[model samples]
Target: MRKVFLFIVLVAISMASYSQKRYENNYVSVVVPNGWVVQNKGDNGLGTELMSFYNDEYDANIYNFGMIIGFNQFQKPEFLLETQMNLKSSNPLFEKATFGKMYNSSFMGKSVKATDFKTQIFDETFKGTAYAFNEGGCTVLAVGSYKVGTKSDLPQIWRTVKWKNIRKDTHVYDSFREEIEAYCAATNKTLKQTPIVSNGERYVSVYLEPDANIITNTYKFVDMEKSSFDENKIEQIKQNLRPILLNILKATAKNAEIAAREMKEGYIFKYTYIDKNDEFLFSVKLTPDDYQ
Candidate 1:
């Protein structure tokens, strides 16, 4: 019994060490909270790839400290500012008057343009910071926001951020092109929206059709890694995320059904939606890393 107890303790320690390590990519790296979920790590609709990270312990419906990073090719400071402003424009509570002056700053040892912005959504006003800079022929932008009455934890995240010069030829979205193209074909839509990978606490959403909302947006996520998929992990994903299908379709009167298929790498989870007239509207597939 004592030997078994020691072995269990060792296993716990090993998992903890793995969970506490920093996540690194070709362009940037950040130390997130141990066991925090990473959502999208690839292409997003902004014509660039995005990496978003958030903790899962917080309720998904509540506002929590999160970070988003985007990479573009050598956009001018003015252009980057305009792009950032456009993002703020989408939020009804973003007060243009509260936008602070653009200023010079440094991030990860590189010169950057910085701005402070305020957004009032619902019953709360959020204070946020944004940074844009050119690094290794690519432009990197980082944005973080926190609700009022809550101290922003983004500063430490920013301080811990490390960047690497990315090559111009690196294809961030190439691996998933075939899957994305097929998804577009099925939806009867042209491949226009750039997909992005974002990390979340419990899932990663790869936007196959970001512009399409309410009725047409198509995306997918799975709970297994490319290296391998485990039965236990698959069951965990099904148990935790099976409700996602209904939650997404809750606002619509359309009927939806989930289909599962087993593959060599892992299982595929597809959500098919049909309109009131029993006509197919759209379908999105959540496959393992094989489709990523």
Candidate 2:
């Protein structure tokens, strides 16, 4: 019985909300609450707030927060409210904003926190549910959401918020983004949109345009020499070249058409673009180190 209780306790800690430890001088200061976590942010150590995270308990859903310090003043909790909306509709907040519930609320009732929301900035709508509280010359926030089983769980999950000492660490997304971006850069390609982390380390970039044909042939010409290409050497090279494009596209969709084929001089392996359509436009030809 004791072991069973101990195991459950460990699991609870492991699965509980995430936050860094904050301190003042030599004293122990409270970090962000345990029920809330940070996400999509660069490192700012544990003291300065700037981040976003997925709340496992938020009705088993996902959300993110971007904390901005000095944005709000004083010891009072001044919370900023915003949404990622295009403002296409006449009234976005009152009508279209589905990111959260009710009027934009604040942590401190008195102070005002400036807000900036960008909807479809990258040609895709990112539903970011975020909240920020500025206090003690510092800022803490929670934003974003994740896939959940049912919407009913939201209230119960949110109830877990400790709202005590919020701890957050910020690390620039540049390092990691640059790492993945390097893969795309090497292949002379740019992601259709900035990636939304589908889950840790992995990013999801979806391109949605009215014209389906535009996506179909985008990658056809780039990879057209598959048939004649040496299976091992050529394919291996192609994988090395455009790993990002391949990973994101493959994860989102299926069905690719081979636009071209060649093998004599060099191995050519062209396939349907990520959004494979009849207008195949990508191709890549690789040759063994020795000769074509």
| Best of the candidates, lDDT | 1
Taking every candidate in turn, the Cα RMSD to the unseen true structure, in Å, is 16.9, 17.1
Kindly list the per-residue Cα lDDT of model 1 for residues 43-63, writing each as its tens digit: 433334555553433334324
lDDT of 1: 0.48
TM-score of each prediction: 0.47, 0.25
lDDT by residue for model 2 over 120-233, one digit each (tens)? Answer: 311224343445554444444443332322232234334333344432222333643332233334222213212212212211221212322122123332323334445575
Q: Top TM-score: which candidate number?
A: 1
TM-score of structure candidate 2: 0.25
Deviation of model 1 at 67, angstroms: 2.7
Count of clashes, each model: 15, 57
lDDT of 2 at 197: 21
